[model samples]
Target: MKKVKKGRQEVFEEGKLEVKLEMIPQLLAFGLSIEQIAQGLGLDEQVVRQAAQPKS
Candidate 1:
């Protein structure tokens, strides 16, 4: 597996879920994996993974 550098750290509780959701794509575009984005935003990897999924 490749090493990942920690990116920007963020906190978006309750009211900021939308903001956090919006950031998922931007972070992905920056080449960050779900784990990295979760670490950066202090969230669970699963939460990031779910949020990263396309809306149905």
Candidate 2:
């Protein structure tokens, strides 16, 4: 019998909040609205916008 391969699991030692914060920029680059990214990631819109900021 052929075995089906499941997707690889991601392990993050930092925390879920950190992972979600990292995803904010990628989500925005993908053209997702701030509200949409916030809702999907279970974060506040303000938080998403803050993460989208360019750091000096």
Candidate 3:
């Protein structure tokens, strides 16, 4: 995974990261699989899987 720069706001400014993060809850609420969300977002399945997991 690429390291995200601290204090950077590029993703927030552009909105792709927010959109992708929001899709996690939306997909979960709709009972969609991680693979499905990943496919829909053109992200890797593992990325979606990790996002779906509870944060420590």
Candidate 4:
């Protein structure tokens, strides 16, 4: 019998937040609204908004 391969799993790690931060610009450029990106990334819209805040 042939074994079927499962799809890739989404592993959430500590540094994932940083990765998300980096992708924000590209995501925004792609016309993805904050709410959309948040939902797609399994994150809260508020969290995504906070992360998108500019640093002082």
Residue 30 C-alpha lDDT in model 1: 94
**Per-residue error at 29 for model 4, in Å?**
1.8
Can you give the lDDT of residue 13 in candidate 3?
A: 57
Order of candidate numbers by lDDT, starting with the best? 2, 1, 3, 4
Worst 10 residues of 2 by lDDT: 1-10
Lowest summed lDDT over 10 consecutive residues: which window, candidate 1? 1-10
**Candidate 4 Cα outliers beyond 4 Å, as residue runs:** 1-12
Residue 1, model 1: lDDT of 17
| Candidate 3 residue lDDT tens string, 1-56 | 24575325565655886679767977888998887888888888887888888878
> What lDDT does the true structure give each of the candidates?
0.78, 0.82, 0.77, 0.75
The candidate that achieves the highest lDDT relative to the unseen native structure: 2
Candidate 4 lowest-lDDT run of ten: 1-10
The TM-score values for the models, in the order shown, are 0.68, 0.72, 0.63, 0.63
Of the pair 1 and 4, which is ahead by lDDT? Answer: 1
- Candidate 1, residues 1-56, lDDT tens digits: the string is 12222222233245477787789989999999988898888888898888888899
Clashes of 3: 0
- Cα lDDT of model 4 by residue, 1-56, tens digit: 12222222223455676798778767888999999989988888888787777778
RMSD of 4: 6.6
